[model samples]
Target: MKIPFSLPVIDDEVIAEMMDTLTRTGWLTTGPKVRALEKEIQIFIGSSNPVLCVNSWTSGAMLMLRWFGVGPGDEVIIPAYTYSATALCAMNMGASVVMVDVKDDFTMDPEKLATAVTEKTKVIIPVDIGGYPCDYDAIRQVLARPEIRKKFRAEHVRQQQLGRILLLADAAHSLGAFYKGRAIGTVADITVYSLHSVKNITTGEGGAIALNLPSPFDNDKELVFLRALGLNGQNKSAFEKNQPGAWRYDIIDQGLKVNMPDLCASVGLAQMRRYRDRFLPERKRIFQFYLNAFSRYEWAILPPCRNDDATESSYHLFLLRLRGFDETERDRAIQQISSCEVGVNVHYIPMAMLTLFRNRGYQISDYPMTYSLFANEISLPIYNNLTEKQLQIVVDTVVDAYYSIAGTEKTNVV
Candidate 1:
């Protein structure tokens, strides 16, 4: 019984949408479908802010940073525990990357964040690790301090308009999540969601940005800049210019080629239509099953799934930690489970431990909590379509392998 770590749920409805897009849409590039998907996303996330679709979350983050005019000498603070994209996007813009530690839940530690801020701090990206929402209210409180806001220096019009430090939620793992009765998209100044195949909801390979910033900073203007940047500063898309007598356009700004195509948007539209009614609920059930089964074992250290009435995870990844297990033992257990045809994986290797970040002068030792979380973390399968039998097999195999490696027997099985 081979069970892969993650699989995107696809069905006849999704296929029909894709086929209709390919055959019916004359404009396959950023066309009506892309616009439709953006609208659908706005509705799904319940955000009045403009939702802009892009080729990837990395692109979306980079666009936001560029729009805010984050550049050389500016500092972009990020958690050391997140994916490389979070920090790398800042580096790409030539801003200094200020790494911070995380809390036990793997979200950015707000206290550490306060100390990391400086006059040069332009943005703080708090990652929602494993589909869990970071403490945005706590982070906001840190930024709202008179001392913190007083130290801020604005280098661009966008920065000046914001007045205080910007909170960008790296919500790649938390699209369907909620924070304090508000959707994750609405909680941050800017939230970027990944629609990659491995994510809870996928658009084959795409992402979207939900802008929740204040007035005077035009999201439309910023999106136009991004579109132009993607097309070598051209002001009009191919579809827009195709209209009779509308070919005349002007160069807006230097942009990057990162617009979402109609093909990807078609798939995303289908996924979003069924997301609330089907995908989210199924993922939650699978998450609960794993939590219930693991609770019986004294060795199991569960990931944070909920925070009273304050937050709810998207159940994107089941980050299970083993007590009394180090990196070597965790790796051994994973290997043993794989041998039993059950595929398990890790959420991430902390940026500080990665070669690129190490070369950039980051040390894993600098982030003790990040390192601790990485060492014992084993991400179990949590997808929409995984059956009860497969779920049982996954739990049983993990238990058998853990006990086998530890040379112990399971006293309690649930």
Candidate 2:
């Protein structure tokens, strides 16, 4: 059947929008469409916070950390089970990365996070693994502790004014997700969403940052930082500088080239227009189908989808786990499935096990739960445009491969 793992859903409408922007708009870099996309995202997520579009989530995250004044001697706590970018952004800024193990559901363990915090901790990035939002309430409770708050040391003006740690949601896998009846974008102080090709919604290669922090921290200031930092610390963007007699501008500080072009924003706008009505529902249905099929199997340990009103996933990835399969058996099963022309993959290997992290004095032995989850996890195909026949083939192929690798009798998966 040749079912692929993940594919971006694009239609004629999206293409027409992109073409219109290319042909009509003389302004391309961070122009009107980019501004429109930011507004549309803010409306879609139901947040009044200002949204800033950037080249990638990595850029957005680094900017957030920089704004918070996270530098040398400061510590940033992150879940060890996430993609390396969650921790790397902090590390790149010269901040110490404190790795915490995740719970069985693959989200950060708030309890472990509480213990990991120290006086040097400036930021805590909780990743939404596979479109599932982490327990924001639990994390808030940890931060609310008088003991934890007393240990916080302010390194910058923003840090001193805030008087506590910043909660940044690494929402690469979750855009339309919900946590405790509120949108994922609004749950944390600052939330970063990735618009990569394989994500739930894409803007070719871009990301956005949603600032949900309270007063004294203005969104306009953050936008200024994004503009200055994205354009070599220039205060004016190309569009703004194009205005009559407005060519003169000032460079505040050294920054990077990380601004999103209007071309990418056009595509993102098209996707956002139909996201809630078309994209989200289909992804949820596909996830439900996988859950229904896999639930009957004794070995299937379905990934977290919904847990009462406290949380809900955006159905980005179907992270399936085997009950007793070790790393070798899981790898063999993946090989078997691939041989059948069915594409399957893993979420991630724990950062502690990676060579770069290992060389930095991290060891897998320190994160038993992270390694336990990584050893047997496999991500199945889940996308908006996947057909019913393809879904059946994916399920059947996985079941067949698992039995073949386990030397058990083949059973009907449909």
RMSD in angstroms, all models?
Answer: 1.4, 1.5
Please list the residue runs of candidate 2 whose C-alpha ends up more than 4 Å from where it truly belongs after superposition. 410-414
| Cα lDDT of model 1 by residue, 1-414, tens digit | 899988886888889888888888766888788889999889998876678898999988988888788889999999999899999889999999999999999999999999999999999999999999999999999999998999999889878888988899999999999998889999998999999999988988989999887777776666666667766578888889988999999887766678889988888898889899998999999999999999999899999978778699999999999888999999999999999888899978998888888998999999999999999899999987899999999999989988988888777544
Cα-based lDDT for every prediction: 0.89, 0.90
lDDT of 2 by residue, 1-414 (tens): 688877776789899888888888866778899999999889989987789899899988998888788899999999999999998899899999999989988989999999999999999999999999998999999999999999998879989878899999999999999998898899899999999989888999999998888777787777767668777788999899999999999998877778899988888899988999999999999999999999889889999988788678999999999878999999999999999889899989888888999999999998898899999989999988898899999998988888888888856333
Q: Model 2's lDDT to the true fold? A: 0.90
Assess the local accuracy of residue 324 in candidate 1 as a C-alpha lDDT between 0 and 100.
Answer: 86
CA shift of 323, model 1, Å: 0.8
**Lowest lDDT 10-mer window, candidate 2?**
405-414
